[model samples]
Target chain A: MTLLDFARGPAMQFAIFIFVFGIVFRLVGVWAMRHKRDLSEPRQPSAWKGGIHGLIQHAWPYKPFRDKLMTDYVIGYVIHLGLLFVIFFYKPHILFFQDIFGFGWPALPNGVITAISIITIGALVIALVKRLTDPVRRLISNFDDYFTWFVTTLPFVTGLATAGNVWWHYETGLAIHLLSVWLLLIYFPFGKLMHAFWFGVSRYTTGSRFARRGGMA
Target chain B: MSDATTTDIPVDLESKRLTVTRPDIRFDKQGELGDDERVQKAMQHFAKDFGYIAANYMEACVHCGACAQACPFYEANPDPKLTPIWKLEPFKQAYKREAGPLSFFYKTLNLKSKVTIEQLEEWQELLYDTCTMCGRCTLVCPMSIDIATLVGMARHGMFHAGLVPHELYTVTEKAEREGSPLGATPKVFADRVEWMEDEHEVDMPLDADKADVLVLMSSIEIQKYPESMAATGKILNQMGKSWTFHTEGYEATNFGMLSGNTQWQKDMTMKIISTAEKIGAELVILPECGHAYQALRWQGANMLGRPLPFKVQHISEFLAEAVESGAIRVNKVDKSVAFHDPCQVSRRGGATPAPRKILEALGVELREPESTGNLNFCCGGGGGVITIHRADSLRYKIMGNKLEQLDATGAEMMVTSCSNCRQNFDDSGEKLHWDKQMNSLLELVAENLVEDTKS
Candidate 1:
């Protein structure tokens, strides 16, 4: 089969299957690990509240760390919001989702979608630059970190390239975009990208643990 | 940081010098050197000790560097390896290779390097000597990863590998074999109590038939600062409370927790639990030791596999409760003081308000620094870092941030509830020629006790 046909049909289905199966397997595997029962009397009434609160509090830079991370924090939000807007609000993307889920939301104007895609690409580029340039970040980052960034940034860049017909045929660009997405879906369950799911778990557990100790989680 | 000297107390350089004799305990090394045995042992330990939260922390870190800014060691040294998340690489590697969903793929692809004994030896400094397990990194981590607890688990693996620093290794060995890290045996404990009783002219009530309160002191206080023990005795006596110091279990500090030996931690905790149970004490008061409070108040029940028969209280907590209940009244002193919250007692143990309550009751003008209460900076001497004689310079360097914070408050005296913190501050103050006087909260209260009119 041609690359485009594989990317559009079987590859997409396989990526979806791996994505779903891998995420569930990872989450359940982690959950199945034995938790040593905490026999100590909790200082707080409920650890659940602390866990939920921790999730909310960590959405923004904590007060003490804000000054040092202001630029990164703002840019991170911009990238996330831009990705969400471009992913779900584009006309073609909505139709694709409708085909799968039997429901769809209204698409944004073409101009707005293009604008978000450009901004998101710019933000992702900036993030990559920071990761490569900053000493601490550069030290901790590995090939997986760079590869994840590349995969995440590729879809927006490819989509924009296709819509504007800048470098290649629209069909070829779209094929590459789908392939990049499949790569991301398969890679999502491994490496640092698991932060997408583990962030919530980490926050909740840390919050609950701190609350049990009667501290602000 | 302020240069204005507000206190008359001079820097006691001589007293600040710590004279710790390294114990002659030989580490067990039955296996062949450089073999995969130690690495396999550490990996097994990591698999056994870690749970869902630890797994989440290991997987969730994005290398954002926020935790690096929060860590005092990283702040002082600006070293990348000292970053809290970086210290967990070994454990994370173990998790990925052993328990991750894609472990088979990782093994086949050789995606990550295997953990080695040499790597663990290098991580020893990062996990124990430099990091104080202060939990400051937990506060700033955007993922909310509990890096401090992860480091603690990492220490457990290191302990199994026999990679612990000789300082901590020696002390833990002594505590396991001799029953006290400082070699404060039962006779030495009794002698110290008798000396305090004679000096203070107050009854110590040694091994009372049945006391409402059982007071536990650390070997540090017994060996170095008997005044803190004397002050605790005076406060309990003045409050007209039934209390006793059991010679069998007076040492509150647990080297097991510090040394990352779980069995030793349980054994040390059981000693105090059995003693308190035998005495029928309703409350067990931990002396001015931070880890001691954590060893009992927090992890005691978990180790015992049951809830404690008696409630454990830190001396600061006990004093705060006494003051609030009108059981002890104090004349407020007119000194401007700032409180240095010990990491274990305030941050981990949740006794932040207790010391403030006691200070407020004493009528001292309490000055709060930028980092106080739950967010208080560690004194850089906790987690057995002070025991390592070679770490003295690093401790002084890392403590510079805390010294500046305390100085910025412009208080005449710095008060803390932990003897370890006091020792750290004393060392740093003397080394830097800092002029602020350091005071223990318990001693300050004892000195300012009002004459009872009811008598």
Candidate 2:
């Protein structure tokens, strides 16, 4: 089979299977763990409200922390928004999603998606630079951190290269992009990328626990 | 803010520097256990602490290291190893190896190693000394990981391993054996109460056969700040509340909770629970202590394996309620004061507004720090760090951040409800040569209490 055909066929199917199976395995594993029931009377009646509050509260930096982490926070938001728009709003990506899910929404202009992708790539690069240079980040970062960064950034770079027709054959570039995408999907459920699913749990636990105690969430 | 003096308490600078000498910890059982046994016990305890919340926290950490910025130890010292998440390295290792969902993968792949005795020894400082478990890191984490809770869990393992700091362990052992970490036994507490009655001319009641309210005091207040006991009596008497100080459950401070001894924590909590139940107390009022409020108000029920029969309120919350309801009145103190929000009481316990409300009722100008209420910085002495003699320099360094925040408020005096926080401020202020007097919210109200005109 040609490289593009292999990328589009068996590799894609296997990647999809692993992604689904692994995520469910992880989610169920986490959910099935022992939960210590808080028997104490709650100061606030509604814990779910606190959970929702926490989900949103963590989206922005607390006031005192904002100025100190301004650059990092900005870069983080940029990278996330860029990945979001490029992955779901780009016409080809939406069409790809439509192929799998049997539905699609109006796609953003290709130019706009491309610009966002580029900006996201820039943010990812800055994030990488900060990770490598910042003392605390560098000390705490392990293989999972750097590897996830590479895994996340590769598809953006390869997709841009393929679409922009930048110094590569279209078939070859597309195959590389597809392969990178598959690699990300396979790794998503295992590595730090799994934060996508667990951040909510973390936030909800904190928000609810604190709110129940009448603490600021 | 105006610099009108709030109190005439003279600054006591002639005292020696804050003690950093390590107390000899009695380790009868721990001494008999081998290193491997300690490690095994630590691993077992860590596994026991494993639950859905801890599992999610471990999985959710993205290594963003934003928690470092929020940590006072890292902020003051700028040491990468002092980063809040880094403090949990060994705990995370234990979790991944023994309890995580992918534990099989981790063990088979050898992704995480078993925690060694040496690592535990090295981590004693990181877990017990440097960290205050102030929950600031938990607040600032982008992933919302409750790093503070994990730290507390890690302490359970550390305690089981007999790796707690000497001073903290000594205090915990004391609280376990003597019921008061500072030697404030039943007899001493009675004497102090009697003394306070004579000294302050307040109607101080001893253990009552049955009462609606049970007033608990920290050993620190009993030994160092006896005025707190008098202040509590004055207020209760003025309000005509049926309250009595029960020697059995008098200790509000729980060094066991501070030192991470869960069993001892339960024992300490149960003492209060049973005592309050014995008296048929409708409410138990915690003294000017932060951890005591947390131990009894929040963790008391969970430790008892059932909900506590009686309600618990911190002294600040009680004062706030009393003043708000006009159950008691206080003469207005015409002075500007900055209120130091205790980490456990305000930030962690959710009594952030209680002290403020009391201050407002007293007609004092409240000069709020930039980081006030639940967002306030810790006094660098919570979480049993105050007792760890080895942590003094680091604790003092961390106090710099709080000092700056408080100084910026430009309030003439500082008032706080937590006796532990007040002691830290007094000690640090003395050593740092900061002239601001650390006043007590309870004392402030007692001194300014308006007499009942009808009487």
Which residue pairs collide, candidate 1? B332-B362, B332-B363
lDDT tens per residue, model 1, A3-100:
78989899999999988888988888788877887888787778898899999888887666789988998888998899789889999999999999
Off by over 4 Å in 2: A166-169, B1-30, B453-455
TM-score of 1: 0.94
Worst ten in a row by lDDT for model 1 chain B: B1-10
- In order, the Cα lDDT scores of the candidates are 0.81, 0.85
- Deviation of model 1 at B233, angstroms: 1.3
Task: Supply the TM-score of chain A against the true chain A for every candidate structure.
Answer: 0.95, 0.96
Candidate 1 residue B416 Cα shift, in angstroms, is 0.5
**lDDT of model 1 at residue B410?**
88
Question: Evaluated on chain B only, what are the TM-scores of all the candidate structures, in order?
Answer: 0.92, 0.94
TM-score of each: 0.94, 0.95
Q: Judge candidate 1 at residue A209 and give its lDDT.
A: 82
